[model samples]
Target: MQGATRTPAYAGRGGSRSIIALAGTLITVFIVNSLIGLFAIQYAGDADVRDQTTLARLSHALDTAREAQVAFKIQVQEWKNVLLRGGDAKDYDRYLASFEEQERRVRDRLEALAAAAGDLGLDAAAMQAALADHATLAARYRDGLALFDRTHPASVAVVDRAVRGIDRPMDEAIDALAEAARARAAAIRADLEAARAERYRTLRTVAIASMLVGIALVGAILVRTSVRRA
Candidate 1:
C-alpha cells in the first residue's frame, strides 16, 4: 500500500514537470517569434527609407542631367548665332555673351550631376570627362571665332569649319550620361515598388503567425490548467 501511494506521487510529479517544460517551450517559441517579427519590421522600415532617399536623389540627378543637356544645346545655338550675325557688332557681342553664360550653366549642371552620380553609386567618370571636353570646346569656340570675317558674307562657313563637329563628342557624352542617370532612376523606382510589396507581405505573414502562436500558447495554458484541476 505504501509503495502504491508513493508511485502515484511520483507520477504526479512527472506530470507537473512535463506540463512546466511544455509551458516553457511555448513561451520560448513565442518570444523568439516576437523577436523575429520585430526584426522583420525594422528591416522593412530601413529598406523603405533607404529606397525613398535614393529615389529622391536619383530624380534630382536626372533633372540636373537633362538641364545640362538643355543648357549645352542653347550654348551651341548661341555659338551659331554669333557666327550668323557676326556682321552686327551688338548682336555678336550679345550672343557671344549669352553663349558664355550658357556654357557656364552647363558646366554647373554637369558638375552637380557628377556629384549626384557619385552619391548614388553611378558612373561619374563620363560627367567628369564631359566637363573637361566642354572646357576644351569652349576654348576652341573662342579660337575659331578669331577667324570670323565679320565684313565678308559666307565667313560663317569659316567659323563652322573651324568648330564644326568638335562638339559632337561632348554632346554624345552628355546624352549618354543623361541616359545613365535615367536608367538608374528607373531601376531604383522598380526596386522601391518591389520592396514595398515585399514589406506588405512580410507584415501580413508575421501578423498571422504571431496571432497563431499567441492562440496556441493560450490554448496550451488552458489545457495545462484543466489537467492540473483534474
Candidate 2:
C-alpha cells in the first residue's frame, strides 16, 4: 500500500485574527497619515495667502505715507508763496486755495495709511503719532496763513518760525512712521517663515512614522508566511 500523504496544519483562528488586525491597523495608519498630510498642505497654503495679503497692505501703507509727505511739503511751498508774493489779493487767494487743496490730499492719504495698518492687524501707534504731528503742524500753518491774510509783509517772520518748528517735526514724524511700517513687515515675514518651518517639521515626522509602520507590517507578514510554509 502507498504511504499516506502528509498534510500541513492550518494557521488556525488566532493567526487569522492577528493578520486581519495587522492589515486593519496598517490601513488605518495610512488613512490617518494621508489626512494629516492634506491638512498640513492646506494650512501652509492658507499661511502663504495671509503673508501675501499682509505684504500688499504694507506696500500700500508705505506708498500712502510717502504721498502724504509729498503733499505736506507742497503745502509748505504754498505757504512760502503766500508769505512772499501774496501781497496782491489775487496771488494771496490763489496760494491759499492751493494750500487747502494739498492739505486735503495729505489728510486723505494719512487716513488711508491708518486704515491699511488696521487691516494688517498692526498696531497703529506710528500712524497715530504721525497724525497727531500733522494736526499740530496744521494748526501752526493756519495761524501763519491768518497772519498773512491780514498783513502779508508781517507774515514772513511768523510763517518762517512755524515752518522751522512745525513742518520739520512733521516730516520727521512721517519718516519715523514709514520706518515702523517696514519693521512690522519684516516681523510678519519672519512669523510666516517660522510657521512654514513648523509645518515642514510635522510633515517630516509623519513621513518617518509611516515608513516605520510599513516596515513593521511587512516584517510581520513575512514571518507569518514563512511559518505557514514551514
Best by TM-score: 1
Could you give candidate 2's per-residue lDDT for residues 86-180 as a string of tens digits? 88889888998998899888878877887777776656776777777777778877776665544547667766775665677777777676677
Residue pairs clashing, model 1:
none
Q: Write the per-residue lDDT of candidate 1 for residues 1-230, one digit (tens) a residue.
A: 65564446766786787688777867887787788888887988898788878888888899999998898899999998988886898998899899999999999998898777777877878778888899889899889988998888687888798889988888888899999989988887887798799888977897788778877876887677677757
Q: Candidate 2, residue 111: CA error in Å? A: 3.3
For candidate 1, what is the lDDT?
0.84
- lDDT winner among the candidates? 1
lDDT of 2 at 114: 78
Task: Tell me the deviation in Å of residue 215 in model 2.
Answer: 2.9
* Candidate 2 C-alpha error for residue 131, in Å: 2.2
